[model samples]
Each structure stands twice: as C-alpha cells, then as structure tokens.
Target: VTSMHSLLQSATFLPQLGHNPLASGPLVLTKDGHIRGVSGDKAHIFYGIPYADPPVGAYRWKAPRALSPWPGVYDASFPRAACMQACAGPIIEECPQTVSEDCLHLNIFVPLEVNFSTPLLSSLPVLVWIHGGDFIAGSASKPLYDGRFISNFTRTVVVNLEYRLVVIILLSFSAVNKSSDM
Candidate 1:
C-alpha cells in the first residue's frame, strides 16, 4: 500500500486545499467541469477561471450572467485573453493578438500547506488584487500583477481578477445615460 505521506506528496493528492478536487490529480471541479491548474513548490495556481459567460453576440452590452459549464477538464494553467482594449506602450503591441469579448477570468494562488484539517477561521487570509487600468486596459497576466512572490512570502492566498474595460463597458453606460436624458 502506498504510504499516506507518499500519497500526500503525490501530484494527484489535493488534500482538499481549496475548491473541489477531481480524481485526475491537480484537477479541480468548480461549478464547471474539471479544471487543471499548475502546482508550484510553494503554491498551487489556477489561472483563467471564467466567472461569467463570454460577453459576446446577444450577450454583448448586457450585464454579466452565469457562466456556462465547459465539456472537459479545462486547462487553466495559462492566462486567457485580456479584456478588449487598444494597444499602448512604446511597442504598441496588442496582447493575445486576438482580444475576445469573453475575458472575465481570475487567477488564484493558494499556499501548499492549506488543507481541510486546518480550521476554517484560522486558515490563511486571502488577498484579492484588482489591477489598476484607469478603468481602461490592464490584465492579470502582466508581470506587475503576478501574485507568486507575495503569496509565498506571506503564506496567503492571492487572487487576481479580470473584467471588461472602459471602452466596452463605459460605452454601454453612456448610451443608457443618453437614452435616459431623452
């Protein structure tokens, strides 16, 4: 029989650290299906988790709604497309090459030591970082937004969330305001 310690050390053992773990190891089942994240020595990172359905097509210009579940174990190891925005900076390069309307994603970093046996109230506090973009453009994928170093140092869980930018969301609000003025 595999020793418990060895099993714990196994890549598949989740120890119920956070969310629901699937049987495939390093894989979690959220409200959606199985999601595979990356495991670091200090923390387990889940990236590009969708909180809402893609704000495209008929959903465009509408408030966010529940996210539709995906079919398979979604690979969440990489960041998704940043919210739609014009390219800036010296190079003036657009991120992801293809911006999408469905860019509502979040990245979560959890300390490796966090486990179910730990008291819920005593568990490490979670810090959520909302990157500043002047309400326009920024992404959780940016280097300045990385949560790994701080999470390791503080032994705290860190979350980075992405949302629609000013161009997309503000335009809709302005239209509504104009209509209301009439």
Candidate 2:
C-alpha cells in the first residue's frame, strides 16, 4: 500500500485529471495564489493562514490592515502563533505558549467533496467558529477548537480565526491617539 505521505505529496486536492479524488494532497488556492495544505480522507486542512497584517509596531493601536500580498504560494501546512496572553497556571501547557502580535492567523477545514467546480448552491456550508476564552484567553488553535471532526460530520467548511483579545482592548484608546497623529 502507498504511504499516506507519498499519496499526499503526489496528489493535488482537486478532482481534475491527473489527480485522485480519494488522495490527500496539496490542492487549495487563495487569492494570493496556491497554498500547500494537507488532506485527510474526508477533509482538507489549511492552517496558519494570515488574514491580516501583524498588529505590531505602528499598527499596534490601529485597525487591522489587509495582509500584504505574498509573492508565492504560502505554506499553510503548520499552525501559527497564538495571540499574547498570560498563561493560566495549570492550563498554560494547553495554551499555544508562544505569543506574538502577528497572531492574526486562521485555520480552514474543507470537506474533500467540496471543490472549485462545486456550484454555489451545492457548495458546502461554512461554519465560522469563535473560540470561547472569556475574551481573555482561548484561541482558535486550541485543541478544544479543532475543526476536523465537525467538518467531516457535516461535510462543510470550517474556518477558525485567531485574534488579539486583551491586548487589542487595552490599546483601543492609544490607537485613537496614534491614528489622530498620523
């Protein structure tokens, strides 16, 4: 039997000729171009996709900017850092310990059957999940929020976005001043 990795590497996510409908492969595309993602029997996983620019430096206190267009296909094969937050004692390990202002990333889980040729009406429904952290802690990257199970069962697209919580709230006032100065 061919190994799953080889199968994934060789196949593209589409059902077009030269591709296998059942094979897991790199086959998703964003407006920026192609994105390398992983596929399961029922779902295609694309993680760490940046929906906005990092809110660092001058942008810290301002509204999110559009993600600058990248020159080539982005590798959405891995998870990105979660937003900055104080660790919750014993629960710290569960947190994506690494923190950054550039944590405005998201994950996408697409059912294998949903493809470019799928009609809008026949297209899979989408589920946008906002993780529960009391608006202070949780992240979309958390294990508790993994979208694979739901995507498979519902045959839908699941998108989970990570965003700054406490930091953004605290900077609201400062952002106003910074913007006025610009």
Candidate 3:
C-alpha cells in the first residue's frame, strides 16, 4: 500500500524505480528542514483536498462557484455531499442535513514535492478527473471514489470534478426538459 511507484507509470516511466538501489527505502527527514536527501526523487502523497465551495443557503440550485483558499495546510478527510437530492423521488423539503442543493464540490490528491529543478523538464504533469456519471447521476463524495489513491500511487496531482444535475420537469405521466430557471 505504501509503494513509492508513480501513480501514472504509463506516462512518466520512471526508470529509477523498480528495486533500484538508489531509490530504495523510505525518505528520512531533517528536523531543521534542510532535507538530507538521496540521489533519487522524493515520495509524494495526497489526502482529501476540498475541490468545491460548500453548496449551502443561497448556493442551493445554483451553479457551483469558487472556494475560498486556505492560508496554511488544510485537512481533506471527508467526502463531498450529495446535492439536494433524495436517496430517491421528489418532495418539498427545503434542504436536508446530509443532502442539499448546495452540494457541488470536488477534491484532489497530489504529491507534496516534485523534482522541480529538472533542467529539461521542470514540473510534474497535470491530471484532471471527471467523476462518476456523464453529468447525469453521480456525486463526487462517493466512497472509494476519492482520487487520493491515484495521487499516492502516481505521486502526481489528481482532480475530481462535479457538475450540477440537469433540470427536468415531471408531470406524473411524462417528463419535460426545463430551462435553467434556477
């Protein structure tokens, strides 16, 4: 579970990995933060990082906007909530505690460090994620759906995106596509 292999081995093809003597053993850190490092690269990991702003109150039934950035490191140990939808059906409930209209948010996972000083290639590759369904039925907060696994394995950033549900009007007998009145 704690292997240092890149998440996207298909892309980077890290020749330095695979039982190499230089790449062996977990990294040891310095108390002074100067990094008494080795010849190879650093191990990377990502946890739960909030991808969307909380969809509460006025955010109900509206497009998901931007999230307020944090000053220091933030904890992403939780899942995004299902939008103002029932576990099924429809009813006149303003907002539920577990599910709400303000439930548009996503999460990401990325390694903390990369070989940023490489002369030929100075940065890590970008990975974007579109979650669950094709914009029909899915929440970014589902269990095991987190990108942390990808981030840890690939040692790169992984983003999980969530879009709002389509607006449909139902009149018992038939279904109708409604405009963006919300």
**Window of ten residues with lowest summed lDDT in model 2:** 1-10
Residue lDDT tens for model 1, 28-137: 55545666777776677778877777778867877887767789878888888888875678535524465678888887776666552333444465677888767677
Question: lDDT at 37 for candidate 3?
Answer: 19
lDDT of 1 at 84: 85
TM-score of each: 0.73, 0.76, 0.45
Candidates 2 and 3 compared: the better one by lDDT is 2
Local accuracy by lDDT, each model? 0.67, 0.66, 0.39
Model 2, span 1-182: residue lDDT tens: 12222223222333331222453455544444555677766677788877776778977777777766566767877778888876678867766767788888878787666554433344456677888876777788787888888988887667887877875677677668667466
**In model 3, where do residues sit more than 4 Å from their true spots?**
1-55, 68-74, 86-98, 112-121, 167-182
Error of 1 at 115 (Å): 6.2
Ranking by lDDT: 1, 2, 3
Error of 3 at 154 (Å): 2.9
Residue pairs with colliding backbones in model 1 are: none
